[model samples]
Target: MDLKNLFNVNGKVVLVTGGSRGIGEMIATGFVSGGAKVYITSRSADACDKVAKELNARGPGQCVPIPADLQSVDEIKRLVAEISKQDSHLDVLVNNAGANWNGSFHDYPDEAFDKVISLNLKRIFTLSQACLPLLSAKASNANPSSVINIGSIDGIRVPPQDTYAYSASKAGLHHLTRHMAGKLGGDGILVNAIAPGAFQSKMMKATLDAFGDIIKSKIPVRRIGSPEDIAGTCIYLASRAGQYTNGAVITVDGGAAVSANL
Candidate 1:
């Protein structure tokens, strides 16, 4: 068994939600570089198109953009339909789209909580279900289809910040990954979650900008996450190297989950 071939994902059909920016983009970039035909979706059509163009320019593979607001079942189905029209099966699905709302416990609004949960947790479950056929169609015991959920360190550990809904939704997603993995394993669909630490994303940009040094000091690695940190993890899980890994929540947080209480 060649180790290099074990990590290869060349020509695999992949879809990555929220791939226009942040961690989603990071994962998509890795897939594209690894020669996978990647479809990236986000709410912003222009951003998606822009990213797709950029990725395509740098690829042995191709990137296509499909913009959709995945907060509703209708939109999720629509996205699935779009993909089915172009491809008969999907090799990997990255549920990376999510939202966060921050507020004090006493002040957090119910509407805010609902909005975050809908996008972060509900959408992931619904979208994965929607793509079941495509995922299953390409799955086999030797090369199982992959579902990689983008969880957060906040889900595994209580953070100092007041992001109640964000944390709750991610925690929920992490468990959902396990549940789905168990249910889908028989069909050769391996499900896993990546719990990431602070990274340079649009989501974390404001906080990092405000107190970069302070945040770095708190983390055991003394720095935030990088694109390579996330991209490499996704590649591992999506490739033959991680075929036997199921129901695992791989924390790529630079030890933040363990050091948070320190």
Candidate 2:
């Protein structure tokens, strides 16, 4: 077996939720460049289409855009149906679509909690269920299908902000990944989660802009995450190199998880 072939994902079919930008886009780009046919989804049709077009132009593989707001069960079902029409089997599913909210502990609204949980936690479960049949169709003992959940370091430790619901949702997602891996392992499906810390994304831009230097100073690695940091981890999980790595929460933080923040 050639060593480089272990990381190759050529000809695989992959779906990345919220692939219009940020970590999802990074992973989708990696998959496309590595020669995997990728389907990217987001709430904004225009954004999804634009990303698909850009990725396709840069790919040895192809990218198809499917826009759907995955905040409701109906939307997830519709998104799954759309994929079913295009392909019968799915080799990989990346549950990267998520939402976060922040507020003072005294005045945090119920709606905000529900909104974050609905998108971050509930939809991941529903979407994974919807995609299971397709994933299982292409899965086997020798070559298992992959499910990559995007979690956050906030889930693993206390955060500096007041994102209560966001933290809770991601923590739940991490546990859910383990449970799904245990249950699905028999069916030839590998489930894992990537807990990222301080990446440059639309969601984190405001916070990073305000305290990037302070944050970096506290981190042992003395820097935030990058697109390549996420893309590399994603490629590993999706490729042959990570077939046996099941039920794991791989933290892609720059030593933040273990650093002493002062």
Q: In every candidate, how many clashes are there?
A: 0, 0
Q: Where does candidate 1 stray beyond 4 Å?
A: none
lDDT (tens digit, per residue) of candidate 2 on 82-120: 889989999999999999888999999999999999899
- The TM-score values for the models, in the order shown, are 0.98, 0.98
Candidate 1: worst 10 consecutive residues by lDDT? Answer: 253-262
Best lDDT among the predictions, by candidate number: 1
lDDT for model 2 comes to 0.93
Q: RMSD in angstroms, all models?
A: 0.8, 1.0
